[model samples]
Target chain A: MWQPSIAPDAVDRIACVGAGVIGGGWVAHFLARGHRVTAWDPAPDAEDRLRRLVDAAWPALEALGLADGAARDRLTVVGTLEEAVADAEFVQESAPEDLALKSDLLARVDAAAPAGVVIGSSTSGYRMTDMQRAAAHPERLVVGHPFNPPYLVPLVEVAGGESTHPAAVAWAEEFYTLAGKTVIVLDREVPGFIANRLQEALWREALHMLAAGEATVAQIETAVTAGPGLRWPFHGPCSTFHLAGGEGGMAHALDHFGLENPWSRLAGPALTGDLRDTLVTGAAQVTAGRSTTDLIAERDRRLIAVLRALREAQA
Target chain B: MWQPSIAPDAVDRIACVGAGVIGGGWVAHFLARGHRVTAWDPAPDAEDRLRRLVDAAWPALEALGLADGAARDRLTVVGTLEEAVADAEFVQESAPEDLALKSDLLARVDAAAPAGVVIGSSTSGYRMTDMQRAAAHPERLVVGHPFNPPYLVPLVEVAGGESTHPAAVAWAEEFYTLAGKTVIVLDREVPGFIANRLQEALWREALHMLAAGEATVAQIETAVTAGPGLRWPFHGPCSTFHLAGGEGGMAHALDHFGLENPWSRLAGPALTGDLRDTLVTGAAQVTAGRSTTDLIAERDRRLIAVLRALREAQA
Candidate 1:
């Protein structure tokens, strides 16, 4: 069994498989972070498309600031997946979302890559556990899902599969943090994970409204970007409601709003004592020693900044 | 029978009933728009709270640029709901969410406000049709629900009940737009309107995740602010996915990522030929004259500005 030897933060050589939009995005992100990347894809025009994507993303990454030695020349597009991972210290798979293809590809990558080098699959909806079922070194396989335009968005949710070691999850989380990414390591594998699930819920509801003719497309669009979407960049649904509870925070909100409402087609969890306590405690932890007053003030300050930024952008 | 005679954009005298967060927010909004506002609330300390809320919101409004003649002193707190609306040209009721309270209050406002004045309720849920049953001038009653912190967030969803005149709904939409709001007038009233239903769906899925131990509160927060939330301010769910469809836009996205994904807690509407056409056409309408390429460029440009602004604000 192989153990992690390189410092999680300092891994220099990375391999990216299945160079479509997501894989190309990962390539752009790594290149900007000043890492040497070896990328592989099966598409006939994968190299040309990947380079175009990287070039398109370059300006934004430069605006966000690039690290020392960051350059597009550092990326090497190889013809074969084995050659791509042969000398790689870390590997990321962003293959098409087909189960049989993913399983077979992951197994092949596992067989080809250096033993114990952690591999992450960027499957938006599949569980890492299921994908790793065919891998020989499943212990090092983890899910490191990212949002669209991975070169810009900072969130990467890391989670280990049932067959994976806890240490691999921790290693992946630290590595992503070192790569100028914000990491959220989950307790277990959940379908679609956190952000996507929330997004899908909202998207599904929007479709339902459109189908019902309750709202038009422009109206639904306005309903979001002009309203709650403005506030969400600084605060999430949970934290926003916590502020809404006035002095009481989440506990107060739960008591006042309750979990039951006729507003959504999605059924919320029962506000059982155990669940309530979990939420209250979780909220208290995230509040991080700030008073509700302080949180609200911070929210307002950030909100003002965001609104001003949006206006400036529009201009 | 009352008819809207004043130019909807130039209505100067407005009445606000109920003086909590939502109501107080409306007061702050109308004041910044340079309208003379009369307010009424039954709470003992309503005046003090309302003043404090407005004062807190003033600086942000100033930053956004106040309308001509705007001043906090233009607001007047009154002794009764009847006194509040008697001389007002437009009435906005932000009462407690109790059906009976809202019904009775609308009836009282309808009876007291001058003929031809339109009344808008700030109820987050509860259809206007249900609330209008008690109003004498039900034809003039329309639901003009604003999101929290109405002074800052610029979305107001306008829809009418069975008893409400289409003219009143149009008047409310025009009035809100003139008052510096982004308005989305619904074709029909649905429970919770559009934005809240979408918000509630996301919120409910979040709570479900928390209860199931699939994610932590901190994870949920980070998942939003750092990931999808950043994109949402510029693109709604439909438009975002439409872009994700690459050159094919919404039609392609619908075909590629069908609504049957097991990712969300809620079930989506079936993609019937009609529903599919509704979404495709809606996406086309919102896309306006821009091609997918142009929209993508715009999104990236705005995103860069937004990210930079957020970073500067944090600094």
Candidate 2:
């Protein structure tokens, strides 16, 4: 029976550093969860951009049912990193992927934030071990990697660095869970964590098919959304295989053909110029001349419906 | 304009050979679509099992709104394969994945069935060429590969072998589309086709993680359904990445870090005894003492809800 010792009030005030899309998304999500969010970004126009991003995303979160008393007014866009995190009980860093910048920024946050308050990084690539090096209180640093439009997608991959205290990791994990995100707390760092790794592998294969003209970008997209993608939201590869094993279960699925999987032979195809152009042009075509704002609105609508559908089905 | 050249009445009579889960599911779908279905299987208790499977699946499809005149009474179980295909304008073979068995049975079906009537195999792995090589009218042989529980999952990977006629492939593609499926007709044969190749690669990675004791089976499953799986039903890997690129879209996504994806290094780890047992046990734990019947029922219910959700979203 392990438990996080932090007061529940600690998570009520969240500071979001780096006000780009990911950082702004974190602001949206934390704000929707009824937290008071203080955000900071160095960009001259980041405040305006963050506000717009949140305003665009709020309807979807609201449709999904926001927490009581949640409002856009709960967010305060501050000027500097030190000002934003000075009183933050928990800090979330979504700065760019530059290692040196993250190290310096995280160290700065650590210096200003209260003692024992955990800081989480929204890096999809860097391991906490690498990113936590410059922090004076590396023990309280954890990686809380999030998906795009974090308000819509629930996953938040939480992992700690080599020197990160187990308690800090646990505290962050519990906080994320409480924040309404699905938390996958890794025991050790694996490159790309979980979802991105699986996603990248599939993306690479699609690139191969496109390179060889085996399938078009539209066809490749269709191959997924209409196929296995339908089942994945409810089941993963392993358990799905378990069911695929028929009555014999996963052991039988593996025994029959699992060993025969050509994983070793499957590698990322080279990203050539033609392939790059194909992807860019094909994606544009897939949009059918829809603006990014239109696409975002459409996606949010569909995602909200999907989330509602799953909830009803589970019920 | 391309056409299947089959009358509406022609597709109303369907022959389903191989009465296992997949075969039975095809029967259920055809029946629910208001088609008269004749099914045959060599197994002694296959009819009983097939009936049970259909009965178990009917409620879900019914909830999804069955076609006009759809009923369980429309399904007829026959004793011989020839009888099943004697009057069938379209034949679907969902037999086991044994190459020899499929080849022999498909040849026999081609010999008996009406000439020019397309016969589709539901093999998850075998290419159409290998399966149709034994058929005399291999021109009409095509692969209409479907995901498990063909009654539910909408994707039907339609492909043709070397000797298979382009016309037959086109007809099957149109026929499946008419039957209310999302179709991806391949210009060339791909090993494991499109979706399975992606699925198997991810499966192998899970096997690697399990073998390495990196995560439990439940964690692997949760890592998916709760994470990327949430977006997959509408967006494929490429489209998802395009959205991940923020305002930059696909070009920015690729330029920023697509090449940095560690797909080249993600070969599947070897499947070992410990890993196998861990998967089996972890799946059992995830089920929490629920029987396979319970699991299947839950899956069908959810799938029906998902289908309804997608249909509504598109509408």
Candidate 3:
């Protein structure tokens, strides 16, 4: 990990290591944001694969309206990792999640990357601390976890390793936001990061249901898409449950049924300062600065609209 | 549980017992659908509460274009359960999820309702088998599990007890679909039902994250609304993972990082004959007779549209 000599906002060139599905996705996203991308991979067919992934994604990107001058033509696949980072303003590593392999690869990138260039790993599960152990300049390495199809899904969980400078974490968060991602900057590491932890939990329950023959895979899925999933995009589980509490809101919800609620069998995160600010700010952003009252109204309006739409479509 | 002498599609009168939050919501939904609703509850203020709920939900329902002749005036809250069910074509029990209480209430409804009428419990967790144990006509009793705010959420998990007639299960499926609800017809019972199990799982992981101080209530939340939550409305976890496999589909996803994937520590439901058909049928409904190829294209198109809308709104 290298520190950035240039300001995060001024980062115009991105170096992508590992030109696979995710790596290609990152490249496509950067290109869509009107940035030059230098990508490198060990596989000989990496360029071909990367091109295809980007091509497949371009129409959708076009549908989203690319930034001025954004085009697939801006991508440059270099021969090696060193060449990819030679003149890069920022580096994003999308290598496999194998800890040893990642740590080794990240160390080499650290050796080659310009000092203070700021390297972010796309590993979903690894703590930046574990992955940064082998890096000579670990302070610049940070985790910038993106969801699948990076060009589409907007969340990027940003965190720094133990040795990493907090400034770098802040810088990665800023850079990702500037690149048009909903950035979640973590002050500490958690296995599976934030999203996956939640996902794994829901998935765990899903597995239990499956193993017990409680429901079919399809049943579990519809339980989501048609039910809770409809509310999820606009409100997190907490906020949704808060809505479920009716006019009483969240506190009453907790007091009445949420806390020690039958489902206490499931786990959750502690409520606190930074996470609170993150949630509040993220929520404000999500709702476009609408008040909770305004949001509640919008959610109901949208839900009714969607419900009507689905009923009509499926009827 | 009672069986309907009338055709499932011919049922125009609905009886809702225990008019609290869930029952009130059911009343609102049935009212919105143009059905003459007869509701009863032990609470003295039940009529006022149910009227308020239907009134509050009316504008949204109106925006969706109410069915012909649909009006809030159609709802009739009676003084007794027997009076409520005397002329009802179907009975929906939304009592609290107390096992013995629900069993007794359902049994009473079975005795009071018109012969051959179907009785459905809106219990979230109790297995239909357990709840039907007290009923003399358990064959007509079915679990009509619904998501919270049942009037707004389109999903309703319909299942039959061990003694329940398969015809009754089919009848409930047709009935709910006609009522403009997406119904998952299950042959057996699973505690927490399917949706709650999935919800509890995700919630469990969220709790773990909290217990460890991994993140805050808000962080765990935004992580969803902004990330996986966006995809969930359009795709279930399985379909989402299938797409995540990048052309490899569900099988490749299972083989690579999914089967024994660290996240496997999470659980799910088992696949079976009737349940399998539900899954497939649900998938088909979710896609609205669209091919997988068409679905992929539609998903990408919609994702890009949502991403663009979010960026513009949040900007």
lDDT of each: 0.88, 0.74, 0.78
TM-score of chain A of 3: 0.88
| Top candidate by DockQ | 1
- Lowest-lDDT window of 10 residues in candidate 1 chain A? A292-301
The alpha-carbon deviation from the true structure for residue A276 of candidate 2, after best TM-score superposition, in angstroms, is: 40
DockQ of each: 0.79, 0.23, 0.46
**Against the true structure, whose lDDT is highest?**
1
Off by over 4 Å in 2: A1-9, A261-315, B1-9, B261-264, B267-315
- Tell me the deviation in Å of residue B71 in model 1: 1.1
The sequence of per-residue lDDT tens digits that candidate 2 reaches over residues B35-128 is 9999999999998988977887776677667999998998889999999999888999998888899999999999998885889999886888
Worst 10 residues of 3 chain B by lDDT: B263-272
How well does each candidate superpose onto the true structure, as a TM-score?
0.97, 0.83, 0.88
Model 1 docking category: medium
Q: Considering DockQ, which of the candidate structures 2 and 3 is the better prediction for this target? A: 3
As a whole number from 0 to 100, the lDDT of residue A62 in candidate 2 is 69
Question: In angstroms, how far off is B208's CA in candidate 3?
Answer: 2.3
Each candidate's clash count: 0, 0, 38
Point out the higher-scoring one by DockQ: 1 or 3. 1
Q: In model 3, state the lDDT of residue A160.
A: 88
